[model samples]
Target: MPPTSPSRCRSDGVHLVLPIVERSSKEPSAHEPWYCIIFSHRLTSSPVESIQSTFSPLSGLINGIFFTVIQINTDVRSAAALLDQFYEKRRILIVSTPDISNQYYKLQNIMVQRAGCGLDLRQVTVIELLGLPPREVGRIKENRLSSEVIEELRQAMRISQAYFTMVLVDKQGMDRERYIDPVTSDELFSYIDTYMLSTEERERMENNRDHCD
Candidate 1:
């Protein structure tokens, strides 16, 4: 089979082509070996259109080949734009990042996605100390901050603090299944409520309620 033309290849999609080679025995009397080639691609389209287009070429390739794996990658900006085009007013954006700078960039993209026409930015929450290992978690619990990491964390926090309403969540006991332990959540929230507030800031925010109304 010939390679797919670049013009036919969709920009919003990926194309994968696998070639199969058959091995033959050294003896001239030996039969020729036959093998199967697999090709797969993921395209960005509406759910219905994606499904319909995916199977058409696949069906022509094999008589009874079963699809074992299918993976889809979506452009976050495009997805958000599509939602906005449909007049989605409010959206809950949950972004996770190992670095604070990436988190801020993701937040900015969300903001850009919802630009214009009464799209209010609400609920900007930040989760610090993400992806901490178990030993690191123990050290944090014991109030021993690594000097090197403390400086890094401080720098990250300084960069991200302005854009987000920061919340420090203790990531102890959080694994693949459980995101944050209930005890950790409670403790973190309590600490925030207790120490993260200035009386003047609180009063100012309370006074601004009339303006909001």
Candidate 2:
């Protein structure tokens, strides 16, 4: 029909195409394609990466920094929530196994790793969660948890001395990630840099954005 329809598609099939235009994300008539230049500076070593294990003050952001180290034979959920009420800083709860009666080799391992020294001590809270059916030492958040909770969590976490199990949580008192049998200080520090520092930076960015907003 009509030379095989030399026109654009339409309901009536009678519209002819006239003009078309194109656009790009570049300057018009530019001789060279646009390029991105990144200005960078020589990265200086931070206090935490000292050559002789110097004291680090949590990257010198110690004004509002805090840390808690807990060692216990309680349920994970109950103990975690219970230990968190001690302070308003970053908290680390090391769930102990049933045989965590007297031998504290596990805790010793952590201290030897530069985790509970210098500025880390100021930010960390060390508590021993010994005895079966972990119990709260004192009233926290105005209420003490039941023994059932501690028992349930103990079975779930299955913390023991034979093998190692560690958790790396965020500053907001949330479970970010967990570790088991970390062999070296680098592995431990790697997660701290990745999760801890990043979380702190993200929080700082959000606060700045809110202030600007």
Candidate 3:
């Protein structure tokens, strides 16, 4: 027991041990790993074509187009509805043209002016003058000849007076009575200022105008 007791004494003792593994301090945790995913769709060259192509996939991601027209009242709702319907179907073409006046060519001048600012006038093609009274259509041709109307048209269209005069001559053979008077610079400026103002401000101005009057 004296000689064997040397090894027997160590066997009765208990020992505590722990295991360790080396890891990078910069490594993300299993619950906090970095990850990213991306998705994309191709588009066509033409804006109209691109709109049509990407519409299905991108409709949910984009606000649909808005169009304003001047004289063609019927076309406005119809066009808007068409665009809405197309967008709902995930397909669309945002073609917009000003409403052509069927009542008086005087209104058409205003439409032309607005159209010039908002649209490519050259792309406009004459379709059948559907549902318009013959007299109304005739009025458009007749108004093109009037010196006063021509001048008003030029001013509103923001083009040279001479250009409108020539356009009138080319469109209509003879002159007619001027329907709209020439707007003064003050009047024009007032209109522009009103246009630039917010809806509340415009309403206030309108109320003030009515009260003053």
lDDT for each candidate structure: 0.27, 0.33, 0.23
Looking at candidate 3, what is the lDDT of residue 22?
A: 28
lDDT of 2 by residue, 159-199 (tens): 44344455444446554555454335455545554456546
Give candidate 1's root-mean-square deviation (CA, Å). Answer: 20.9
TM-score of 2: 0.36
Ranking by TM-score: 2, 3, 1
Provide the TM-score for each candidate, comma-separated. 0.18, 0.36, 0.21
Off by over 4 Å in 1: 1-151, 154-195, 210-213
lDDT of 3 at 72: 15
lDDT of 3 by residue, 1-213 (tens): 011111211110111011111243343222221111001111113323322333331123212322211111112223232123222111110111122333333344454444321111111211112122222121121111123332333343233321111111111111111213333323433443433334644553444332211
lDDT of 1: 0.27
